[model samples]
Target chain A: MVREQEFLYASGRIRALETKLLSRTIVERILEAQDMDAVMRVLSETDYAPDFEELESIYDFEKALENSMKRTLGVIKESLKDQRVVRFFTLKYDYHNLKVVLKSRILGVEVPENLTTLGEVPVEELLKLSKGEKDVAVPKLMRLAFERAAEVYEETLDPQQVDLILDRALYEELNLLVQDIGHDFLKSYLAALVDLTNIKTMVRLKYMESDLRTLKKSLLPGGSIDLEFFEKMFQEPVPVLIEALAASNYSKVVKDGLENWVSSGSPAVYEKLVDDFLLGMLRKGLYKPFGLETVVGYLGARENELKILRVLMVGKINGISEDMIRERLRDVYA
Target chain B: MEVTLGQVLALLGAAMAVFLPGIGSAKGVGMVGEAAAGVVTEDPSKFSQTLILQALPGTQGIYGLLTGFVVMQRIGILGGNLLPLTTYQGLLVFAACLPIAIVGLLSAIAQARAAAAGVGIVAKRPEELAKGITYAAMVETYAVLALLASILMLFGLKLA
Candidate 1:
């Protein structure tokens, strides 16, 4: 608790940064922009405003967006006294990078160029570890994950198994880290993420008409909701899964998701609800002036923004309708 | 020259009045300084606004110093004119300094937290600096009351 108090300033500064985050209105303007020139004009109004000459492709703008998020995380990390809490949030990116590396290895292709520099492990080291190099150089938990994922992938010859193995491993790693710190907000946040991910997996698998066994295998462990619940819950259809979501802490959020799912027959609404729920929880953590919540919250918001920017930018470039692009955007941090 | 217990008690009271709240203010200001610097680091334009918020917790130290100065002068510690004191009279001054010593210490730290958060407000929303200042200033009420209680008691303590 005393250590949490040390972040009093850093958290406050984060709250300040939250206000500076591009608002829904700003995003709306970007969406409403007439053409690429108008999009550039809108970008000029934002923190993203820099040399327009450089952004020839939407991919460049996407890189710039990722860089901005990276910069923000770096600044927040620099300010924090104990960065371990923030480090846990960055672990998601590590897992993401892990997936990328593993997929690249499986496909016999080079690792994608858009690899984020956001995680604790360097890209070079992760890439090396993925190629079956030095066993001791990488973190033990990550090495364990890589080994598990590789074994599962080799045995099943299924890429999905690799994803599930790594996904479960990531949660286990996060659970260990969050529990060690014992920050109530972070613990709750991690639980929310797990539940949401679990729920999403259930929804997606059910939609694909997957068997209960496959569904159960996909569900990640280490969530606050008992593992027994998911074993039972995964047996039900997508609509029945809504009952579980309603029973859990996501009752309010699940209402809209379930309604949308019933009406549209799409999990898009449900997924968005979960995203908003997760983001809302993180944002609410900011009201308190101390602790790891703010640092983690900033990173979460940054990640969400990157996703939103990419979707909106790609949606615009692809000439996707405004309504479609708007539907695709997750809840904004600001 | 023999130093009496009565004079010693008076001196101890004065010393605490200076040190306790001073320490609190130092910590409070330091805490706010860290937050303010963080804000300024992100947005340099917010420096002035954050600077004002950073200064809020410092009042406790001033209040503490004021009480200590009064106690010192009354006891002739600072005036360079030593006043002979009985045990009971010294106890009165000691009891008088207690309000600021304890309350000032707690209040300053509490205020510092508010002030630090205020620095955040200025960082994110520079136009809302006044609201941030108001929030931080709200925490200063208890400190001010403690200072007042201390000063009034110090002034009321008439030593024969």
Candidate 2:
């Protein structure tokens, strides 16, 4: 395709860079590293980063990791021929910051420390918009979500509604952006992500034995499993609903998770498996070689790598067991 | 008016041999340059290695120029005189140029993609630059063969 040719160089560079991604063996070694010092030593071997030599504590390492993530995002944005794709990926962070701001405002406190500063909107502007100040500088979608979330929080005096409002608004805006982009592959990827997110919500609510109305309210529409379609599936029991997912790409994950959930009754494994399934969806982008897929896929890979490292490091700091830390690790990109 | 149709044909053959492959090589080299620039922007240490890969796609232009030069000399155009070529001989010359003209254009561009990809390999792993060059060189074989075929045909052309 002409699109493929357009991205030939960027994709080629990414392919080479991907070869240097942390291998599963290396990640395993890092996880098996006995102490934080040992872990940081193994991390120093990889590009886990260049400036983390001063990282003595988990907080220090997080800051370093956050900086690297910001740099990587900027690099990937610069490399890609399409900035729209990056903008679309950035929407999630804006929404995430929006949520943090709302929570901070609700608590009548300053915006929490280490709230991710990875979005298009600055923390200052997002906080302004979250406080229901009329700031035209804030993005329209972000402002809309913040105002709506704050209004609902005021009405119900429930923090839950704020999350529901923002999440729904996030997906609604993301799906619209995806449509505007008009790339079928991305559309499919985002659709699959939406489906996974909806499943995550359903599983969480189902395990909590929350009311069906709450579950219905939490459900994000516009996935392949539309809200209209899911309304029929909603009335079914959690196990049966999970069984329905067996027909989807998450068949193995849902089935295996369902088997485990029966004994544990906890959706933890199910949630992990589903998160992995989402990454698996992103993994298939490697086959495309040239497109928005490689750029977006590498971002996903980098994000997953960061997440695993954080999990491993935090688990170490908290004196958690190896198996517990390993259980939470996402699949490695390499 | 003094130039015969045969002379025009022979000149066209020379032009085709030079222009098509030159354009192909230019495009190929430019593409590789863009890729190499990106790598160099990230890591300046890879400049020498990427420069080598960037030069790979440029050989087709030389082959094209050589073919064009030989054709022009054969017709005495470069020598400042026009040969009185028959229509058949003109067609033969035109046919001879086709191998390099077509293949050189295509192979150069293909080689450019390979060379650019090689620059990527060099960017990430400088030690693997040779392997990347080998990949780019694979696309060079067809261009060489095409040049050989064109040269052989041109030399073997019987002027009547």
Every model's DockQ: 0.50, 0.27
The DockQ-derived docking category for candidate 1 is medium
Clashing pairs in 1: none
Clashes of each: 0, 0
**Which candidate tops TM-score?**
1
| TM-score of the A-chain for all models | 0.91, 0.92
Clashing pairs in 2: none
Candidate 2 chain B superposition, TM-score: 0.96
Query: After superposing candidate 1, which stretches have Cα over 4 Å from the reference?
Result: A12-16, A51-53, A110-114, A244-247, A285-291, B79-84
Instruction: Please give, as one word, the docking class of candidate 2.
Output: acceptable
Q: Once superposed on the true structure, which residue ranges of model 2 sit more than 4 Å away at CA?
A: A5-20, A49-51, A54-56, A110-114, A131-135, A211-213, A284-291, B41-45, B84-95, B123-128, B156-160
A193: Cα error in model 2, Å? 1.5
